[model samples]
Structure formats: C-alpha cells, structure tokens
Target: MSPSSEEKNMKKWKTPLWAAFAAALVVLLSGVAALIYLDELYPVGLGPRQPIPFSHRVHAGVKTISCFMCHSEAPRSSRAGIPPLETCLLCHSRIIRTYPYIARLRGDAALNRPVIWERVNWLPEFVYFDHSMHIQRGIDCGHCHGDVSRMDRVVKARKFQMGFCIQCHRYNRATHDCYTCHR
Candidate 1:
C-alpha cells in the first residue's frame, strides 16, 4: 500500500479509547444531573437560588407590609401576580437606595426591566385554583403559604399533595366534587 494510504487506513482503524471516553463522559454528566435533580427535590439547608435576594422576613415580617400590597392581584384575579419592579421601587426608591440589591433593582427599573420571582409552591396544570375565591372565603395567605413573615428565603413548608388540599377542604366545609380543583 502507498505510505499515505497506509497512514489513512491506520487513522480510520477503530479503537476503544474514544468509546471509553464517551462512556465516562455520559456517566459523569448523568451523576451531575442526578445530584442537581435530587438537590432540587430535597434541599437540605437552603431553597432554590433566585436572581435577586428579596427577603420576606424583612418586607412582610418586620416591616409588617401586607401581602396584598405586593401581591395585588390576589384579591381580584385567579392568580396572585408577582409585584412588578415599579411596585418594589415605590418603597425601594427611597428606603434602601444605596444597598447593592436595591441598586440593581433600580438599574433594571430604569431600563424598564421586571424582576422574575421564582414560584416556590406549585400545583399541577390539571388542577385549577383561584386566589380570589380563597381570599373571598376568608382564608388567610398563611394557610397555604405558611408564615412568610418568619421566612427570609421562601421554601415549601409542605407538599401541595391531593391529601393536603382534601384535608383543608374538609375542615373548611368546602366542596369536594372533583371539579372544584380538578377542573
């Protein structure tokens, strides 16, 4: 065989080295992904990371700011819409104008950017929940959200499992006709 063709044939010969490398990479990546998923499912001493560190302990607890003030849509809408940066700026514009976090908020506000807060509690897409209905029923936010006044970093206090909702409904004497939530 010609020297160049022989060299090309040698290069084309299959080896286990590439296969081993790919297998090792897959195992390593899978382990990392498992750790991340497990951490999210069961956080030991912390909650999920947010883009900003907004504290409920300081805002709702110490400051005694009502939940309605920030979650304005709770009273009238099906979902409680997260307060926009403009709403936060109402107080932050003057309260902590020099703090690094507030300063970042100000910058975003200047550019008309909104802060995206993470939702700690979750409900399945098949289940329909109405914040206004619950609010009208005189159920305080603490019933579902736990005492936010005591929490700095929000964490899920309890799983929103079917049994949890059923129990609450039974105690409150609310309907349990499946359609009440499963709609």
Candidate 2:
C-alpha cells in the first residue's frame, strides 16, 4: 500500500477508537458526577417526617439524651427498633400528661394503638445494611448520619450510594466487597 493510503486507513481506524474512548470517558465522568451529586443530597440519615415533631435538638442537645436511648436497637440489629410506646410513657405518663399535645398519645397508648410515626430514614430495597456491624465496629454514626446531635428534624445526610459506600470503606481500609452489601 502507498504511504498516503496507509495513513488514510490509520486515520479512519483511529477516529472510531478515539470516539469510543471519548464516549467511555463521558460515561465514566458522568457516573462520577452523578455519584457526587447524589452524595450531597441523599445522605444516610433520617428520611423525613416524625410523629410528634420530636426534636433531636431538644432531646439530644438540650436534654442530653444519648442517641442510643431512643434508637436503642441500632447497635444490635439491621433495623433500628422504634421507641416503644412504653418508653415515651416513661416521661409522658406524668410529666406532660395534662398537655394537650401529649394527651392524645396517652389516650392512644391506653387503647393500644401504635403511634403512627413517620419513618425518617431508609435505604433502597437492593442494598443490605447491617446497623449492628457498623455500630459494633465503632464507626462514628456521624460519619454517615451527619451531626444529628444538632438537628431538630432528622434528615438524610449521607448519600448511601454504592460508590459512596465503597469510598467510605476504602477510606477506613475496610472491605468493599459487593457481596457484603449486595446480598
């Protein structure tokens, strides 16, 4: 083949390769940018809504209640158990019995109706998270949950994306196995 013909063929081949490379780069960068954007918005803390507008600011900050006191089961199970009605009654049974806001709670508990607490935190169905393992490992709840020690209404603070999870594991030199969280 002549030199010019060989060069033309090489250029033609290179064009597709370069285009594929550019496309792949765009996809990779987009995935990374998407992960970053999601991480900022959808954190791994509470979702939204509460039954009685329970303020962590009051209970955790002013009253100094430990996080474990209410989310008492976080260190033991995948699901953090909700505070039983009896737990609330421990204080409201007498402390605020006469207050109109609390009177309804008293009436409901008397009737055995579970308080309809709106859940504030949740993960997507595909991800399997073990609160016990994280807690047992002495991981700071604030790492993924943000500084709820100051929040009134709980909000999602950590974007619980797969990349975010892997990044966190990498930072802590922990295992980032797919089966660890996928199954």
Candidate 3:
C-alpha cells in the first residue's frame, strides 16, 4: 500500500481503538461506583436484622442489667457466649410472655431449639481474640464495642481492622508481636 493509504488506515483504527478503551474504562468505573454506593447503603457498622429485635438500651441502659448477666462467659472463656433462651425466659416468662416476639422465644424454648442470634462484631478467622483476656486486663466492653448500653440495635462500633487493634496494643503496652493477634 502507499504511505498515505497506510496512514489513513492507521488513523481509522486509532479512533475505534480509543473509543473502545474509553468505553471499557467507563464501564469499570461505573461498576466500582455502584459497589461503593451499595456499601454506603448497607454499611458494615449497621447491625444485621435479628430474628427478634432485642434492645440493649432497654435491657442494659434502662433496666440496668449487668453485661455478664447475658454474656455469662465473658470473663471466664475465650468466647463471650450468647445467652440461651432460658436466660430470656427467666424474666420474659413472667413479664411479656404475651408479646409476639417473646412468644417466639417461648416456642423456641419449648421445642429446645436455640435462637440463632446474628453476630455483630467479628474478626478474621486467623485472628484470635480472647474475651476473657481483655476482660481480665480491665478493658471495658465499651472500649471495643462502643457504648452498647446506648445502642438499641448493636451495630459494629468500630472497624475491627489490624491497624485499630495494633494501635490499642501499642497504647496499652500489650504484646505488639504479630503472633499475639494472628495465629
């Protein structure tokens, strides 16, 4: 082909190539923006909907129930165990047994089925956090969990990220070794 014809062919291909590249870039950016929007709508901090709405403000703040009353194992075990249905029934059986949500609790208790409570704060599987250790070290629940007594729906108080935990460890002069948190 002649030089001028080759140049014309190259110009034609360049226009379409640039247009295709721009189109792909727009699509990629749109997808990223959509994911960010969705995340904002349903943030990690916003607590999950439970099977039954249990208010920490009412129980812990208003009623003045001790944290240990519900989480009986916080001080003694690695896992701060979720209270069984019987714990709810202890007061609920007499107080609001007629309420529909309470009635569901009653039904679960009667059938010996556990109420599957949604977990709010969770670390990665590789990260090991002992509730007892923190509790023993005089770390109040609020330190990590935020003001749970004020929250009706217990949302994730803080981002349980590595940097956050590391900062805490450094401040408290706790073991800052990688193995201290990561197993």
Candidate 4:
C-alpha cells in the first residue's frame, strides 16, 4: 500500500479509538454522578421516623439504661426484639403519663396491641446475623451499632456491606466462608 494510504488508514483508526475513549469516560463520569445524587437523596445518616419519637440519647445516655433493658432478647436470640409497649409503660405509666406520645403508648398497652416500630439497621434476607453470637463472642454492641447512647435518633453508622462484614470476620479470625453469612 502507498505511504499516504497507510497514513489515512492510521488517522481513521485513531479517530474511532479517541471517540470510544471519550464515550467511555462520559459513561464512567455519568455513573459516578448518579451514585452521588442517589446517596444524597437517601443518606445513611437518616433514620426512619418511628411511631413515637423515642430518643436513644435520653433513655440510653442520660437515664443510663443498659442496651439489654430495651432489647431484652439480644443476648439470648438471633434478633434484638423491639421493646414491648408494656416495657415503655413501666416508665411512662408513672413519669410522663399525660404526654400525648406516652398516652398513645399507654393506650396501646391497655389494648395489648404491639407498636409497629420501624427498624433502622437492616440486613438483607440472604444474610443471617445472630446478635447472640456476637454478644457471646465479646463483641461490643457499639462496634456494629455505633454509639447508640450518643445518637438521639439511631442512624446507620457503618454501611454493613459484604466487604465490611468480611473485613471484620477476617480481622477477628472468624469464618469468612460464604455459608457463614449467606446461610
């Protein structure tokens, strides 16, 4: 082939190559921007609005209530069950019995109805997280829960992603096998 023809072929190839690189860069940047936007819209800092505005700071921090007081089953069961309305009424029945929110708690207790509290820290259904196992292993609640005594409203402190769990398991020399968590 002629030198000029070769040069023309090279130029044609370079043009498409540069165009493809530019397109790929745009796509990468677009994905990053979309992630940032979604992160802002649904932040980990935001907790769900509970049926009653219960403050962890006031109860756990100020009153010095132990974590086990409200989550009575954490040490014994896989689930840290929400405190029954009767448990709340044990305090509210005498202390703030006239307050509207406390009144609601009182009414619910009277009828033996459970309060539908919104769960804040949630794991995917595939993963099996046992609170009792962690408690028995001497893992502090703060490690996963992040200073509940300090938080007025409980927010997700750590992203609880697979990488986070795997890192913790590997560091602690716990099982990092897929079945350990996935099952």
lDDT winner among the candidates? 3
By descending TM-score, how would the candidates be arranged?
A: 1, 3, 4, 2
lDDT of candidate 3 over 54-170, digit per residue (tens): 999999999999999999999999899999999999999899879999999999999999989899988889999999999999999999999988888899989999889989988
Task: Go through the candidates in order and give each one's C-alpha lDDT.
Answer: 0.88, 0.80, 0.90, 0.88
Clashing pairs in 1: none
lDDT of 2: 0.80
Evaluate residue 147 in candidate 3 and report its C-alpha lDDT on the 0 to 100 scale: 90
The backbone clash count of each candidate, in order, is 0, 7, 0, 0
* TM-score comparison, 2 vs 3, better candidate: 3
- Off by more than 4 A, model 3: 1-46
* lDDT, candidate 2, 1-183, per-residue tens: 457987888877775668799999999989888877888645444446666667787888888888788889999898778887778788888786788768877887899998887765678888899988988988888888788878888787867788888888998788877888888
TM-score of 3: 0.74
**Selected candidate, larger lDDT, 2 vs 3:** 3
What TM-score, over all chains together, does every model reach? Answer: 0.74, 0.70, 0.74, 0.73
Clashes of 3: 0
97 Cα displacement, candidate 2 (Å): 2.5
